[model samples]
Target chain A: MEAIIAVLLILMIAGSIYTLHARDLLSAIVSYGIVGFALVIIFLFLKAPDLAIVQLVVEIITLIIMIAVIRNSSKEDLQERTTVKVEGVHYINLRSALYLLVTGILCIGLFYYFVKSIPGLEPFGVHTTRMATTYIEQGAELTGSANLVTGILFDFRGYDTLGEATILLTAVIGILTILRIKGKKV
Target chain B: MTLFVLCFILFLVGMYGVITRRNMIKIILGLCIMEYSLNLFFVLIGYVKNGVAPIITKGTEQATFVDPLPQAMVLTVIVIGLATTAMLMAIAIRLYRKHNTFDIREINTLKG
Candidate 1:
């Protein structure tokens, strides 16, 4: 299981890098899709079937929307643009490269120290779940829902779900308002 | 443990993309990747060894189940991500229509 997860993580990293570096817009989108699907697999392996299902569906929808947006713009137009120029020099110079390297190392070092400082965290699994245990043991009795996840989502944390629904609705409305064509008034 | 570190690395890669890339779509993709890495990290944090799914079935005896809170939360996060991605894509499309390009460098009409 560990080896499988490690492989998947490596694949995800590679896919993201490819997505970032791909010159062509279509290929970049495809690489991003690859990363999304790998994430779905990782979720399944981590025992989060609910997340896996939701991620799979959302990944497909996101890919479709991105592709549709890409289809509207021409490839040549997207490629002809250059980076920000400073005194006739491109932004991707030695200074920016060194800055990126230093920042990456600093962030990784800090994260490593923080992870080491945390006590009682096992290597692979065995997380101590106080609330989760309570939820599992008394969830059915409290909410009368067979699935504890469903019960928690709809009954226990219903307000959060409601908020998420509202956000989705607002996003749809915003998209419609932004994409609508304006008629000229003579 | 190692998985968490790798996830963080992925997040950093996304950050690098967002900071360095000049294309608007690539930046959006970087943001999406960051979101995915964070979601994965949260789900992994809730994993238990030899754990079954959180769904309860009749006449089944299970001792351990994965934490359902992160799963539920991630479900909401995924939907929220979809909405945000849609909005971002809409804005990107509008930008393209106005500027005829997706490059962030050239869409600088507000530069003083």
Candidate 2:
């Protein structure tokens, strides 16, 4: 099981890297879908059906929104425009190369420190539960729901859900405002 | 152990995208990647070796269930992520409409 999960994680990493570097915006968005779907499978493997369902639906909606934006935006990349065409032969710019080198070094250093800091946390698959033990032990009885996840979400932590709904409402209002045909009166 | 490290690496990959990429849509994609990795990490932390989904169905009353707290939080985060993504997309579309390009480097104007 662990080996399977490791493979999926590697796949997700590769997909994300590809997404960031893909030449075509459409292809990048598609690769991003791959990462999201891999996450859905991983969620299932981790025994979180609730998350899997939510992630799957959200992933699809996100792809639709992104694709719509990409379709309406300029397709040509600035990097492609900057390519130096010397006698019909393209040459890479030195500035982009230098930027890549610097970013790569910084990311590697950050990854190294992150790995070093992982020792402070508990080992995987052995959660301490803390207060969650009660949530699991009596979640159904307290909330009268078959699904413990739903029970805890709507019962034990109902305020958080309320805040989330408010955030969604704000996002909708903000989007409507931003996308208005006219921002100010003439 | 390695899974946790890889999850962080996924996050760094997203950071790389946001920091290095100049396109507005690319930046949004980077943000999405970072969001995903963080959610995955949270769920990963709550995983048990041999656990079932956190549902209290008949005949499985005593089953060891994965922690429900993170799952619940992630569920909300996922929905909120959709909302935020839509909002970001709206802004990006408007920016493209005003500037006629998605490249952030080219869209440099404060005056309407």
Candidate 3:
């Protein structure tokens, strides 16, 4: 399982790099979808299934919106755009490349050091699992809920989940308000 | 181990699109790809060695319950995914009509 997961990560990285360089519109969008899906899987391997689900759902919604907007799009060569020429315009260039590279390297380094320093991480997970099992053994008394996950999501982390839901709702509302055909000012 | 890496690679590819792609549709597609790979990863997370379905009954007295929470959440996630997709598609359609062109470079009326 670990080996398989590793391989998946490698593929995801490669895809990301290719996507960065991709010039075509369709291919780039498809590549983004692929990347989102890959991240979902990676989250699973990390034992954060909830995060994975959230990522998957959010990504799908975003993709659909994008597709609908660009369904009738036509490719054309537009005039060359300049960053400095347009005030307050952020354009892509070699400087952006440096930022990306720095961020990527920093993330990689942080992950490596964090893992190396975190000892007995397995034991920690085992402990969490054991705690959950304990709750299961004493079900009904702990949270008055049969489903532990539900309890975990809705009870222990209720506030956090509520926040997430709110964010999603806000995004949906924002999208609707922006794209509504009634022509009301957003 | 390798699978984890593969998933990461897929994520990176999507990132590539997100970072560099200029077309609206392509950006959306890139987002979708990233979402998919992440979902796959999550489903795999709940899997246990030789684990069986979470259902339990008298017939399978010795059966072990695989964590059902992840699967349940996944179902919900799928629905949400569809909803978001619909919304996105609607926006894309509207944008295309308004701009009359798909090239993001041409639709530069929106200023940052």
Candidate 4:
């Protein structure tokens, strides 16, 4: 199991890096989708079926939305406009390499320093936290939901969910307001 | 443990893309990558060894379950991310229409 997880993590890292450096926008988006799929597998392995389900659906929706946006726009304009040219070379320069080196070193050092303080991985299948125990024991009785995650999302933390819904609605309105054609208000 | 480190590395990679990429769309993709890595880290924090899903079934005895709180929180975060991504893409389209280019280096109308 550990080996499988480690391999998946490695794959995710590779996918992210590939996506970051891919010259084609469409290819980068597809690589990002691959990373998202790997994340779904990780969520399932972590025993969070709810998250896995949500992630699968969300990933597909996000990919479709991004592809639609790309399709609707002038791809040739973007391709020609965004490409960087330095002398005879295109898209590779000294500045990006320096930035990559600096950021890579800084993150490695920061992560190493902080990760030492984190506790080691606990044994699998055993949640030692008190809150988790409490939630499991009393969640059904208190919230009348078969799924504890649903109980927490809708009952225990209903206000937060309400705020989330508001945010979503605001985003939709904002998108419509921004994208509406001029002189034709929706 | 190692998983946390990998997630952090992914975050840094996204940050690198955001800082180095001049294209507006690439920057937005980097932001989405950072959001995803952080969400994965949050969910990993609550994972238990040999834990089952938090769904309760009739006449079934389950010994352990992954923490439901973080799962719920991440769900909210994911939806929020979707909305924000859509908004960002809309803004990107608007910017493209106004400037006729997606390169951030060339869009300098607001420069004082």
Candidate maximizing lDDT: 2
Q: TM-scores for chain A, candidates in order?
A: 0.79, 0.85, 0.58, 0.79
lDDT of 2 by residue, B23-108 (tens): 88888999999999999999999998788898887878987888899989999999999899898888888777776778776676
| Model 3: lDDT to the true structure | 0.56
Q: Tens digits of per-residue lDDT for model 1 on A1-186?
A: 978998999999999999988878889998899899999899888888778888898888888888888885875324333355889876755645665777678777867785775555555687788777778888988999988889999998999999999999999999999889662222
Residue-by-residue lDDT tens digits, candidate 3, A52-136: 6677777676666554444556643222233433477666565546646765775577557645644633321122234345434
Best-to-worst order by DockQ is 2, 1, 4, 3
- Which residue pairs collide, candidate 2? none
For each candidate, the alpha-carbon lDDT, in order, equals 0.83, 0.86, 0.56, 0.80
Runs in model 3 deviating more than 4 A are A1-69, A75-176, A182-186, B57-59, B100-112
What stretches of model 1 exceed 4 Å from their correct place? A76-122, A181-186, B109-112
| Ten residues in sequence with the least summed lDDT for candidate 2 chain A | A74-83
Q: What is the lDDT for A13 in model 1? A: 98
* DockQ of the candidate models in sequence: 0.63, 0.69, 0.25, 0.55
How far is A102's C-alpha from truth in model 1 (Å)? 6.6
Minimal lDDT window, size 10, model 4 chain A: A74-83
Model 4: DockQ against the native?
A: 0.55
**Predicted model with the maximum TM-score:** 2
Stretches of model 4 off by over 4 angstroms after superposition? A72-98, A119-127, A181-186, B109-112
Predicted structure 2: lDDT: 0.86
